[model samples]
Target: MSGEQLNEVRKVIWLTGASSGIGRSLALGLAAEGHQVIASARSDVELAVLETLSSNITALPCDITDASGLSFLRARLSHLSSHLDQIILCAGNCEYLDFPEPDWDMVTRVMEVNYFGAVNCVKTALPLLRQSAAERPHIVAVASMVTDAPFPRAEAYGASKAAMRYFFDCLRLDLRSEHIDVSVVNPGFVDTPLTQKNNFPMPFLLSAEDASRRIIENLESRPKNYSFPKRLLCLLAVSKILPALWQKIVLNGADGKARQDVLNEKVGE
Candidate 1:
């Protein structure tokens, strides 16, 4: 659809993780464009602030990791709108493993939010999306480019996003028959509350607002998979080609000593 067409037609959208980061920015952007955005997040304070931003936005606070809360959210959504034209699943959690004494449970914790949380949202939104009058109702999952290349300490996060990407890919195939468009958005480093905690270098990092704008612009096309920025995607492609070189760069110090040392310092702080 063209920019004019998007502005002409209003869509009922359900956006998760709207308290901060990309989700919050997306909700604001969509609402500004005259879309009815039902925004959700775990933070009541932040959601309340968002609700004050525009009448197009409705704050619905719910923890993606909480099954009961999500169930309640579904009921609330049903009451608010019988159908949804779009559902953006941006809710996710990230955790790095501390090697040698890694917190094993963190893997489950991360997956529960990043992968299963999205799954639950899809379950709740699919039926609503089926009722859409639009030619193609959309499901957008904000995954990560970390899945394209292996990163130390990002095992859980990378794995969860990879799983999400695959699941959505399969879902796209199945939902094609129903005219439900599914797009997996794989973003590189974006300066959000999540990435603000990173101690390492993040090349090509875009601000959350810029990232959200890019995503919103591209989403109009409803592509199967949208990954950005092109520069970072290219870098990851090169890394995959040279396995030995890639390993050397990732494990710079022998036995990953340099990586571990940095992590240890962060933990100390």
Candidate 2:
């Protein structure tokens, strides 16, 4: 189906983290659907390139984590349009804390970028979203599926996302009376510049384009919480119900026992 078929009305959308990864692909997809996309990211050069891809896209580069620097963003948006119909909060960072004298600051750093950065975006964009001509404006945030289960070395990343999850959930309740809809999307592994650096295996990973397509399609319904890749969700669910089993599996892999077991099988062969 065409984008027009998927999206009924064109919108003025503010999308963060549009320089790369899932955000970049999502911006392109939304722009192609005839929405006025204001793409924001820290990289000026890449945002420039993204703008060149479509006439509907306007590159407005800014760091979401910089509270003081967000003045520039607010000014730019005011100059661009009277109100924003939608805002997609996709900017985030991850830091895994390894055992044995890990840098404890990684938790604060991850929270600043992932959780507080989202807070900053929402605080700045709330008034504009309320001023939208659309009857019920939308706020969509890209969280993570990792929040459903614990993982080794994911202390910082998981906690930050968990906080984000709760924050959005409560925000959804608070905004409902005002007729503003909020959605928290928890996506599984996707093949992106960020995930490419991950050392462990990523099962049932999706390409950025595919992930973007799904997000656009699903957000139309505006479910309160959306998580993808059912297989991964099931694994995380098991981690909740049978935590000991999950721990056994995770510990085996983390301690290299799984690898040694494979080697033993190879030797027998």
Candidate 3:
């Protein structure tokens, strides 16, 4: 048997942000592999289309930020399956803090989706995840590599992802005794609708398909954290070892035009 098949046990997976980008690709990939996928998104129409693509996928539209509405979401989810063997918290959003008169509200907005939304999913799924028959159920979140280095105008997006990274890290420790595993996936720039509007150059930009494939392949190992592509991580490493040099790169020139271009360009992160 193939390693992929050997690892496959036909898990019931709940995936958020299923309407587009990485979430859409992951839904298709997991469903193609014969796993049952309960895909959620606020875009009910898009979720409907995704459901038609595979018998293995069931559309469960929801607003992850809706704290009060989660009881309804959970009830709907319970109606779909007895338990969730795994959950991929892929639902996210990005908003930049542009120069001068930046909208400070973007910080709260970004946190609502990328951080609180993820936590909400975990809150709703814990009971179901606990009921899974798998030896160790998995909880996964798709954060961003932007947290590795500070970027101008990326204050909101970066802070939200950094918060997400830490939350999952702590959750991993708490869940260890229950044999439930948690993993945080931090991907560098990927070509997606979210990044399509980015005007700056994205080094090592991978297509959504390529990014999804890498995520699927690596997730089987259930590492506490996974960041990619390797080259991008290496590039960001300079920010840590050589803070002065990093500042020179980001704060160069009176206008700091280069750094501005980078943040607005990568709002998707």
Candidate 4:
């Protein structure tokens, strides 16, 4: 299909983690394209701000960690409209595992938000997605490119995303007969409030707007997997293809202090 035709296809979209980063950018971009967007996040204030920024957006704030809250989300969305064309699960958290001491609690926290939170949203949104009779339903998950290869100190964050990737890939198979399309978005570093906390360098990092545009563009194609910044993806591919060399030379030298900090934090915890 042509790009113009893809752009013309409009439908109701529910987006999680819409308070900031790629989620926020995508909400704005999709809304500008005349699609009805329900923006969700834990922060009501941020969701409110996003609602003001776009005429097509309606703020729906809820913490994905709360299962009961998701039921409330279902009720609220049911009130908005009976069906949804797409559900973008972007709510996630990242925590690095430092070397000397690994904090199990930190890992659990990351998993709860990154993995379980997404599953909860899926459980709640399935009915709405099923209501789409004309357009094929889509589920877009915001996983990380870090899952492509292991990165130092990214134990918790990477594992959570890896689990998410596996879940959606499995879901794709099960939802096939139902005509639901699943897309996994594996983004390289994007400048966002979350990454702003990183003391180390983020090579080939794209602006959130750029990331958002790429995501929206790829979503139209409805590819099973979408990963960005060819250079970073290529690098990760090379590392995966040659693990020994990458371990000794590339990955080991990236960020020493950050790795040490992660270890220290784990030890302290």
Best by lDDT: 3
lDDT of each: 0.86, 0.86, 0.88, 0.85
**Per-residue lDDT of 1-269 in model 1, one digit per residue for the tens?**
22233334489899999999999999999999999888998898999999999878888788777777666777888777778899999988888998989999999999999999999999888888998889999999999999998988999999999999999999999999999999999999999889888877676789989999999999999888999998778767746787666665567775545754543343342
Lowest lDDT 10-mer window, candidate 4?
Answer: 1-10
Looking at model 3, residue 257 earns an lDDT score of 59
Q: Over 4 Å off in model 4, which ranges?
A: 1-9, 254-269
Candidate 2, residues 1-269: lDDT per residue as tens digits? 22233234479899999999999999999999999888998999999999899988888888888999766778777677678889999988877887898999989999998999999999888988887889899999899999998888999999999999999999999999999999999999999988888877566689999999999999999999999977678766767788886776566665455734533343342
Q: Model 1: runs farther than 4 Å from truth?
A: 1-9, 253-269
By TM-score, how accurate is candidate 1?
0.90
Which residue pairs does candidate 3 place in steric collision? Answer: 198-265
User: TM-scores, in order shown?
Assistant: 0.90, 0.91, 0.91, 0.89
lDDT-based ranking: 3, 1, 2, 4
lDDT of 3 by residue, 1-269 (tens): 22233234489899998999999999999999888888999999999999889878889899999999988888888888778899999999987778799998889999999999999999999998998989999999999999999877899999999999999999999999999999999999998889888766577789988999999999999988999998788878878998777777677755535765553343333
Instruction: Look at candidate 3 and tell me the lDDT of residue 232.
Output: 81
Q: Give the TM-score (vs. native) of candidate 2.
A: 0.91
